[model samples]
Target: GDARGAGRPTGERSGRPTGDARGAGRPGEARRDSGYRGTGNPAADRYAAKKSGAGKPRQKPSGPRAFGGERFGKDLGPVRRPKAARTSRPADELDMHNPDGVRLQKVMASAGVASRRVCEEMILDGRVEVDGTIVRELGVRVVPSEVSIHVDGMRLQLNEDLKYYVFNKPRGVISTMEDPEGRPSIGNFLKNKNKNERLFHVGRLDAETEGLLLLTNDGELTNRLTHPSYEVPKTYYVQVRGPMGPGIGAQMKEGIELEDGISKVDSFKLIDSTPGHILVEVVLHSGKNRVVRRLFDAVGHPVERLVRTQIGPIRLNDQRQGSIRVLGRQEVGHLLASVGL
Candidate 1:
């Protein structure tokens, strides 16, 4: 007999033990030792036990996870946040139904007393009276042609038939229609042209200064054109007493501080140069009295002569001095449109 199968049962070398070696040895000893419970063959029994997991340990059951204090698989509908509050005023507080009339300050400003802002301040200070009653409230509306407005006890009238004219004002003639000293006035030009209408000059040129001067009976148009808000540009040909330095034009354009306010020029350029004198063209929008002369005076070079060549869209091209001419319909329309009428 072979040594490996010395103590085994018969037919063990052929991979099949006899009946007693398979299950007839002990009570539960054959099942555990042979690794096969129901099969009679020992090799067959070992193969069945390995595939069925007969010796493996079992795992324990676990619970589901928690999300926001609720079960992970449960539904929670939609999430919402609160709305913010509004900050604007209520609709009832606004004056939606405004009456149809021009503002009191606007009418006063158009009458040439002062600017709109200054007129408003004047009204609030009780210096203005409408139809014999004091009007201190703002936004008080009235038809200027229908109502009688007085400032400091002097009544104002609105001329309906608006007339516009351009005059080449000569030197040494007063800008006013009548001068208290009985000097040569603009009225002489109007009389020569046979124009008998009462007109006020838009802005004044000093007796010594000469050039284009606008005469109009339209108070509203006059105010609009002269007001600083409109920014109506005026061009002048100036002759200064000394030779201008290289940067004098830049200095003028930059700005100059005067007693009344800060004056600024839109542009300045040299037109001609002579011995001890320089002629330059300057453009500005200021309606202040003697602004052109004052600006040159502020600099070291005083103005020897000043002539306004243009006002807004109107120009004094080839117009003879001391002559007056009525503005055409197209020119009048253009002037009004330039200043927002």
Candidate 2:
């Protein structure tokens, strides 16, 4: 029924069949061909396309695209940009976050040569130089890398001093190099000074109070001991104007109120007492100004004489008055332990 065996000129049959003539007998079929047909019948072309593998399996879109309907043109939504590359920076650039750099005056003050202001004077006087060059500026940055800092041509090792001495500070001796009013200072009592390294006092002993005081050139240690959070304990021997009755102990233990607020005594003991005066030992952990004098004055008594016997775990020991002794390594360790350093 294909008409191929009749050899009716395979040209017409093999090329394209005349679908219009074939559909003439079928009126409804000719209407279907007229919708999309060109010069040749679209139904014959569609049949040929199906036979030649045009109707092969088609892949379904997946994920977000599976739900998206057909669209025209290329997708032009945002495209991610690559991250920029990082470059190295120089060491001189300040972090601005860290504040560990020591100030110029403080470095000089800690070196034991002078106060911060005095060090500036010395620097301006052409006495301070760094790495063989005279530097007269205040707050000149100096790293602890042996940058070769010197005062008046004498090479100064800012941290090499390691001096730690306890002075049985005598009354009338101000705890400084030279008093502004020309009064004799603690430096007057010190003999055989080392010119290479400087020395400075840790804390002050008033001009009229005789007690134990430590001196050092270590700035870091000085900062730590003086830091309020440390709460370093100080023991004082007080000579008051009246006999310390049992009520005195209770009042001291309860904390006495001063003008500033309550002044606390960690512990107190009545060492010896007379009807006219009492010798009491008080232990406290405050760095408030003139605390012992104020506490006694609060309790209807006055301190006739006060002497500091201990700082933290360091005691004056048998070191006599007017004598200076360096704190031993073990003693320094005990001091660190007292403040939980």
Candidate 3:
């Protein structure tokens, strides 16, 4: 954006800007009411202004600067921008009213949707929805926490009470917030963390196991994710002794009997292998404690190292171990929708 301005001849930096000629070193600078402009050079600017009849009276434009602060061809009169394609509808048709409630634009802006004015345009353009219904009205009022808002069909989470985070749980660290045995726990990473109100780990990862562990204060989401009924997927990276036999993945997908129950992997992939050790990926929805280790043990491979790389829609990705990262709006939205929250 600055490249064009940097190379501009009439910029504030191109020689002295203060002179008898108004806006010296500024090229094509003209009043909205007047088309006559300055062309940088003092003598040339005076001549051009005189030639264009700079002093002639002009009609003031009555509306927005949609003309891009300069004139375009007269044919494209007042066309704003290319909004996303959606069925055109009258905003006033939907009469969602709560006089005491906050404005829709305010809620959207607070949720990081966009600036207040841009949000208004989005509402007017029919890009925002509330409670499964498209709402184009700018004055629509509803409680941010109560309504399910979506922008362009992506869910927007607006509950300020809820917080979401992803932590890379390194090996040797206990999963609990506070360890009674005085071992390194999740609390260590949160020492300087200011937002500790009701912050809870979503699920458990054994002290020896490591990788992505979702942390959140949203109780309902936590319960739903860990609950067996929802069957939220969790993926793990397992390191085990190599020269492993084939079809272990098939055997897993088929069924593997355990003391508690007959559990099976949703998916399995051989990530890497060598004679000494091998890395494999295991996906399952079971929340059983130490399930990954037991799965490998049942297959006669025995897990040497284990890492929970992903939990449902959230992935560890490139985050460094022992670090905590806040889940963004999109991530939180998908997470909430995963279990129908």
Candidate 4:
């Protein structure tokens, strides 16, 4: 009785267990309490047990210490193998609106069917049909497995063989396709040419001037070659109505001051001379509008006829004023070598 507490009253519940039948003294059994007599509720006994055991210390389960020790396991069991890459996530996909995706016009152009812009116009005109259905939208995308595209009712195929050529264009042809004013264009020379590859001029050539021009379907190469900062050399043969004096060549080489600014020729030389006419060669790296004509005019020798004779290592080579020949691989290589390509 004295072990219960000092000077405790008789039969008082001391919030602890005495050696009674309810106090089973087992590992998981609850301790007995005189205050809980006749309660017949196991919930209150379980709650009391949980509250008492929570005050006791606890031990962490087996694993490396989350914050302190270096007990990381040595089990090398292939690490649950990262959940086998899901096929639900696609490897690659084509987006119709993306510029680099499989675009309708570019697909037609690659098929040797027509120029991209022309194909676009054809789609708008309902001339281009895919798998027997007309596709008039601009950004319609198609994959190789999903498309059987046709232009003008004929199946199309992509041409892989790239062709590059240089043309020493003559005057009287506009650079564009079907000019609004209905003037003749250099494209006439390319029309119905029995060539498999469709040709496109890299840069513009004005109606009244002539010079070396590059033509190819290789857009990347065209972009690189025609960029103005490349400053590729272009040589011209100009005939003036009057003899250009000796010092005139020097002054032109030194850059002729025009109404706009100092217009310059890279080099110049008098080739042939007559009392009323002078034939001279002028070299320039500029593609400015009528630059050679403007320079000659600035120097008091308005050009009577202007013909571009050479561009880089390419020459006109006796080809008629309105003819074109495909450039050989070696020639293309030489051009690629130029401009530090």
Model number with the top lDDT? 3
In candidate 2, what residue range of length 10 has the lowest lDDT sum? Answer: 89-98
Better of 2 and 3 by lDDT: 3
| Candidate 3 C-alpha lDDT tens digits along 114-159 | 8999999888877988888878677688877678888877788888
How well does candidate 4 match the true structure, expressed as C-alpha RMSD?
A: 19.5
Off by over 4 Å in 2: 1-160
lDDT of 4 by residue, 99-150 (tens): 3348788777765556898988787776876656676677676664456565
Q: Please state the error at residue 308 of candidate 4 in Å.
A: 0.4
lDDT of candidate 2 over 1-341, digit per residue (tens): 76564765443454444544534444443233333322346677667655554435557775445646343336855333333342423223423111356655667677566778898878656687666666655546666444655665454444444777788987788888667898877676677663334777767777777788888776766787877788888899999877554687778878888888888888988898787988888898888888888888888788788888999878987788777887765465456555543
RMSD of 3: 14.6
Ranking by TM-score: 3, 1, 2, 4
Judge candidate 1 at residue 297 and give its lDDT: 90
Against the hidden reference, what TM-scores do the models get? 0.52, 0.51, 0.70, 0.50
Predicted candidate 1 versus true structure: per-residue lDDT over 260-313, tens digit per residue: 988878999889888988898999998888988888899888888889999988
Give per-model CA RMSD. Answer: 23.0, 20.2, 14.6, 19.5
Residue pairs in candidate 3 whose N, alpha carbon or C atoms collide under 3 angstroms: 10-25
Residue 175, model 4: Cα distance from true site in angstroms = 1.5
Model 4 residue-pair collision total: 0
